[model samples]
Target: MEPLAARTIPDLVRAGAVHFRDREAIVDGAVRLTYAQLGEEVNRFAAALAARGVGKGDRVALWAPNSWRWIVAALGIVTAGGVLVPLNTRFKGAEAGYILRRGGARLLLVEDGFLGNRYVESLTAAAETHESGTSDLPDIVTFDQWEEFVGGGAASGGAAGPDVTVTPDDLSDLFFTSGTTGQPKGAMLTHRQSTELYVTWSALAGLVEGDRYLLVNPCFNTFGYKAGVIACLLRGATVVPQAVFDVRETLEVVQRERITVLPGPPTLYTSMLDHPDRTRFDLSSLRVAVTGATTVPVVMIERLRDELKLRTVLTAYGLTESCGTATMCRPDDDPHTVATTCGTALPGVEVRVDGHTGEVLVRGYNVMRGYFEDPRATADAIDADGWLHTGDVGVLDERGYLRITDRLKDMFIVGGFNAYPAEIEQVLARHPAVAEVAVVGTPDERLGEVARAFVVTRGPADPGELTAYCKERLANYKVPREFVFVPELPRNASGKVLKTTLRSR
Candidate 1:
């Protein structure tokens, strides 16, 4: 796939309308549109935003799920020369307010009543308890009035694109951290950074023109917005949005829409395979899958190929700070390689494990400009030499395959040996009875710290049996000292296992 001629997000819309005018651009429930129609809708929304004083560099917060409207709203924000600030749907009322206040969002577009939750009301209720009160909240726009708002703005601007010039270097989106450990700091990305990266991502992931990609990932996430929606636009592929990831619902959509491209974490595949009614769904359309996490179970990759008949299953590694991508396995990579490692970095980007500590460091165009409005934090993250310290422990083999071991904070010391949970989890996941597992350190009298395996079993599994399993395969010092069975592992909306929560337990 050639690099997009248009550098900016807004210009991508313009180019798409002309090049893929007849290709299906979006599919959301009853709504379907061609690239031309999508371009028109984006133009209308941009005009409205521009009319409402959303000038260049103004921050506009968007709180919504995966949908056609969210795509248009996001594109419109950038097209109007506004910096997009996306709020996670899983965020609490207070969390939403914090991002809005911190990002200095002048306007907030929310989905209102989704899954019986009123976001605006929640934000309002949360704000009343805040020290700043409601005075700091941005103007709220609900999903119900979407048509009216767009029509009014289009009427004023008269169907022309917003009167603004967006350059490649202009800020495109402001992505904030999950704030699990502290207040979230925004990562600023320019148009060129996001556009250039995902264009390469789309190509490497085997995304092609006319492929129907079911985006189960949230639009608020880097993978969903850039790799899902924007990648589709960049590749002439169709965007099929799923608001929330439900295994059965995912199957239904795949069967109904003939979805060809499915990208998600490994948990998505596991849930689908375990569903009782999975085999009933016609999933022959699934061909390409892109998944990544702390680790990928080799068995799951085989099952996806054998049971689901997906041909191209790839693994990748990245962080939010890297614009959601750094390295990705190629389409032709073997299942074991795909399961065990994230491929080499993209061309022009550099990746190396720290010589003494094995922490992954990335320096490239895709690295975020810095943490928004926090010079100290930004300087701490990106060194003067331009290398961004990822804080992730990984191994870069001679072949350049990057194997993520664990987060530096998540590594455990058992006796005098180092234990990476991802490595242990990979071994445990091979057990027929084990569906998923997380290993964390717990204080031990003899060893100072020992690994405790939290297992979600598919079949009957005993702690004694698991201990012997680890003992036979792993070094004595690396074997988990305890095992706990649970119905499911706790995870954030983005499907990362909550190791912090597990350690607390």
Candidate 2:
């Protein structure tokens, strides 16, 4: 009930079509939409990207997935003042042709054969196998000419919505990410740093107004486009997308969309609580979820509240240079404080931790206004006191709650102390046959580096009983001198764990 002084998201879709007009904003399967027909299909795709010339600050891109026409072409590319890059529907056309040529994207609007992969024949065979620098290639707009490109953008005689202004310091969305110099940079984000910090991340993840949500994370990540379609268009909820992530078609769309806000990634609620036809759906209208990890499994946060009766199961932390959120976890915390911490630090953000190397830094308006044009990797990631160091590793506690613990290039000194493989994969994800764990560091001429665990088991596990259950709860140089077990956990289509292909096996 509070989103309309809108600092642009096309003025929060024209003040959410006159304050949530007939609510139900987007359903996607049989395609429903409301909020005045999602503000007239995002003002007719921002009047067909201003009749295809697409001006104001340019840069378009958007390769599709999670539909409702990728939320009306990403709210019609920031409502035609354009910026919105997006891509990564698992990239690979030379990684979406180097972020549509390093974000100079003057238009792409793809979707050509989505999961069947024909994005303009894989960016024209990766620019004819020269694999990138697709010589300034933009202007494509496929997906069967999107309804004849929004039926020839009804030029002005169609009640204008493309005269476009978009302020709150413009540039609304660029994204990219992947950088330990493996390339892909673009971050940008404004329109008042994404409509004023996702309305303070949807009022610290409470996200009210007729809820419903369920967008299985992946609108080119930022947890599915800024906490899944701009926090479900600032709270008049109902989004529903789910293009992929099929735990039997997500328990039949949260038992036929009675879904009540289910954010993802604690292995998407441990693959819907180890789905064996999870008691035949009807997840009891789930009721808010959130999840984050480096370790969340206090018996899967007490079985997502005693077997999927989830009533706000949060845990959080962030990265994507902080716009993917920074910290969270307070829906009356406890489940071992939402499974070993990450909460706190979102209100005007500022986290800190480096008491000589615990890394986690941050500092607010949700960080990124850097990276996009690289500037020497944005001064090696926001320094000179504007903090944002974040090379991962964390600690914080004293009620300041953070936790994180690994990735100062995945720490690992051993025998000289400092070991963090997410602190032994958060203590081998509390064994009971560890279902998915990672930990790395393997090169040991007698402990110059040791911890090796890889594990994925959900049933029969024994590396000497998981190295005597991490030598009875870790600290013998944080156990695991080698565990291995596999069957899944290579991950990198933004699902993370590749711990450099498990330290090259």
Highest-lDDT candidate: 1
Candidate models: Cα lDDT each: 0.84, 0.78
- Across 311-416, the per-residue lDDT of candidate 1 in tens digits comes to 8999998877899899989988888999999999998789989874488999999999998898988897899999998878888888889888766656654532
Residue-level error in angstroms, candidate 1, position 75: 0.4
Residues 1-505 of candidate 2: C-alpha lDDT, one tens digit per residue: 2454677788787777778889888897888988888888888888888888897988888888888888888888788888888876655566678778888888898888866767787677777765676645777988678888887888742345677677888778888765443456888878777767778777777888888888877787776788877777887888888877778888888888888888876766877888898898788988788877356668988998999877788888887677788889888888998888878887888899888448888998878888876788888889887888878877887889888766766755453333567756765786778988988777664345678888889988779988986765443666877888888889988898878777887
Clashing pairs in 2: 407-410
TM-score, one value per model = 0.81, 0.31
Looking at model 2, residue 406 earns an lDDT score of: 67
lDDT of 2 at 111: 81
**Stretch of 10 with least lDDT, candidate 1:** 411-420
